[model samples]
Target: MAIETTSFESRGERCAATWYLPDAVGERWPCVVLANGFSGTRDWILPDFCRRFAAAGIAALAFDYRHLGESGGAPRQIVDVGEQRADLLAALAHARRDPRIDPRRVALWGTSLGGSHALTVAADDPDLAALILNMPAIDALSGANVEEKRKRAGVSRARTVAITLRLVGAALRDLSRAARRADPLYLGVYGEPGEAFFTDPELAPRFRRVAEGSPTWQNRVAARFLLGAPRYRSGTFERVKAPILICLAEHDLEVSADFIRAKAKGAARVDIRTYPVGHFDLYHGDAFEQVAADQVAFLRAHLGPR
Candidate 1:
């Protein structure tokens, strides 16, 4: 199998992507359109799953949302949930147009926030053959107390202060732009304790590892996303008519299984699997293998032969 670097347009901006193709030749393959979590890039651990999908005789297209990673968008490092969904739709169109892909069997797979987008897209796109979601952050407005735990995560005071000041500056800059209906402020995608983009200690090491030395990975996002997240709901899981596989982390501190189930109750066909691992753990090691196997089986069952 060979991985090809690629790009496609979304709302006139280029969205960078990678295409993983299986060895099967002359046959149009069933493809999976993969989108990454919250401010995540295609290169950040997603290649592992995409490789597995290719190994299972499927093609996988993992893409970065506009304004993030290698995508072409101004006022970078922001996560507008709506824009990300639109980017996925654009990627779907790109996949459909590819001669190597079987548009009728194209599937959608996403993780974390990207999972939310996958469900949202599947809700409206009846042509999709299957859907796979991992630890989906279904409700952007999930007013959880996890922030307190993130605040308590240990980080050097000097670094924290520096990041905090930078966030404040970015916020001010964004405010000025917004007054004229210009671009919003940019903030770090993740930071240590007492800083904006903060994640808990349990998740920080993994995030930092995924971010290290990645050419397309940026440590920033639009600060105004904070204001819109609470109102951004991806509860369309119920509206999805495709066969859906939802993987939940048993010890997930971010998204609750109960909440996910509540939203998915109305789905015509849903299979919920619980992994005895944390949210970030499924991106690697044994947990990833388990989930990837299940996903391949599900996709093969739903999408059929390559």
Candidate 2:
């Protein structure tokens, strides 16, 4: 049950991570570089899941994105998809070179934005063995639009576009300010008082936890992410070459079916499992523990002999 833990420098960043590997495993172990949630840090969650993967005899690497958690970057909680994807690549490279890992069997287990990036990355890397997307944030704009699908939400699409563009501009302005190490949250961390994604029921508790624990939740995402997201998902659904496993939360206001199926068009294989739970349920509670077991079984059946 005791796996080795360590820290390393990657991507010109100081990355804090843990390596979970069971004793008596084969010489070349398959490794997984777990990507954290979009607005969350690795410390806030994933350590438990990392342990589960380790007990399954899979070496797992859990790390913070550059601007979050123990990783090095500032305007400390900024979100940049392009840079984080690069960080994922750097983490993968580090995992592949790990002495206890097998490069040929590298897999990605990503949550939220990390999940989508994992899918997009694996799409181009045909050597990737498999992918596990846990309540992934496939497309922010699309997921945000799903609410409109049911309740009209009384929102104007043009207004959405305009405000989003304004936010993006604000984010750009912050980046410029950050060049001189100025405080980015001149207005406050979150976009609006209650207009953010987690303002809904399914995500409120998790959002509260973020407020209590990370202190970074007050950090705002670069508005540019909204613009780049649609482009990143371009051809993503159909270009993936690896087998896919999607863990959907029935009450997950975030992970939408339309998002995953749309991007998985070219994936060699796909499996979708939905649980009667909320977005945060996958991390804790008896339900998630069992889900973890199922995930291990799935990984064992498809990615390993253990």
Candidate 3:
């Protein structure tokens, strides 16, 4: 596959993007956008997913949300939902204008955090042909609470909640300051640095190696993300007009499965699949291939001829 790297502006925010095309494939093929997870970059993970899409003659573009990787933006490491959505919109516009893609047949493939973005984005854009949610997180209300984790770490609920809230507020304030170009930053995005939560997983030793390999592994997330992201709930699924395929990992420790179950009911045109494995397993194991095959099959069936 011949991959091209580039950038685009969304609401004047510059974002990095990449287009993957198969050799000899014409511009008549449908385009797909691959949205990354909470701690992810455009090519942060493996481009194996893009290769699969390319082999099927589907043009795929995967890019970083601004400030995380190559994308340009202030407040590095912040995972604000609104900003990521703007990036997704920019990516869609760039894909549509590309000479090798069929703009009318464009689709979205989201993983983890991107899954929620995909759902929200698809609901607002009616032109999408298909939507794929691999371990989608439409309900932030469903995940493990920061307070609970702190409690388990020997911190009191009141203290933990208060601490987290303060951090979130500080990060937001930092962003506000940056927007105004007030001065060089003193506090970091994590808002008073401490050990990150990704390292606190229950099965740390077992999955640590692969988890550490994630492009965002060493990167500490900004506290502003928790505060900046609109608290997303699955109730909006009713507005999603595109066909959706929801893939869930049965043993996911990051987000609650029940939240996904509740939201999957919103979309009248929805298909759900469950895997016996955990969250990271879907990214690089037999389950990954199995789920990819299912996703490609679903996309092909929906986007291809009868």
Candidate topping TM-score: 1
lDDT of 3 by residue, 1-306 (tens): 788887888666678778888665434788789888875876555377888887887788988888777777765766778878878888888888977677778889988889888888998988888999888766665554444445545767676667666656666675676578664233332222242434344545534553455444334565446555545654677888889989988877666666777867878699999999877678876987998888888888777742
Each prediction's TM-score against the native? 0.87, 0.83, 0.83
Stretches of candidate 1 above 4 Å error? 143-176, 181-184, 230-235
**lDDT tens digits, residue span 1-306, model 1:** 989998999998999999999988977999999989978888887889999999999999999999888889877777888899999999999999999899999999989889878878888998999999888876754523253343455446666567556656666677678778786666656664324565565667776676674667877777766555533244566668799999998877777767787777778899999999877888888998899999999999998964
Tens-place lDDT per residue, model 2, 1-306, is 555556666567787766777665557887778998766676667778888888888888887777777778766766777788888888888888887788888889888778877877787777888889887776776654355423433446666566556666665776676677777533333334223433344455665676797653454564434445524456675677777888877766556755666666555588888788766788888868877887787777667743
Scored against the true structure, residue 150 in model 3 reaches a CA lDDT of 59
Root-mean-square deviation per candidate: 4.0, 3.4, 3.7
lDDT of 3: 0.73
Whole-model lDDT per candidate: 0.81, 0.70, 0.73
Alpha carbon lDDT at 81, candidate 1? 81
Residue 240, model 1, lDDT? 80
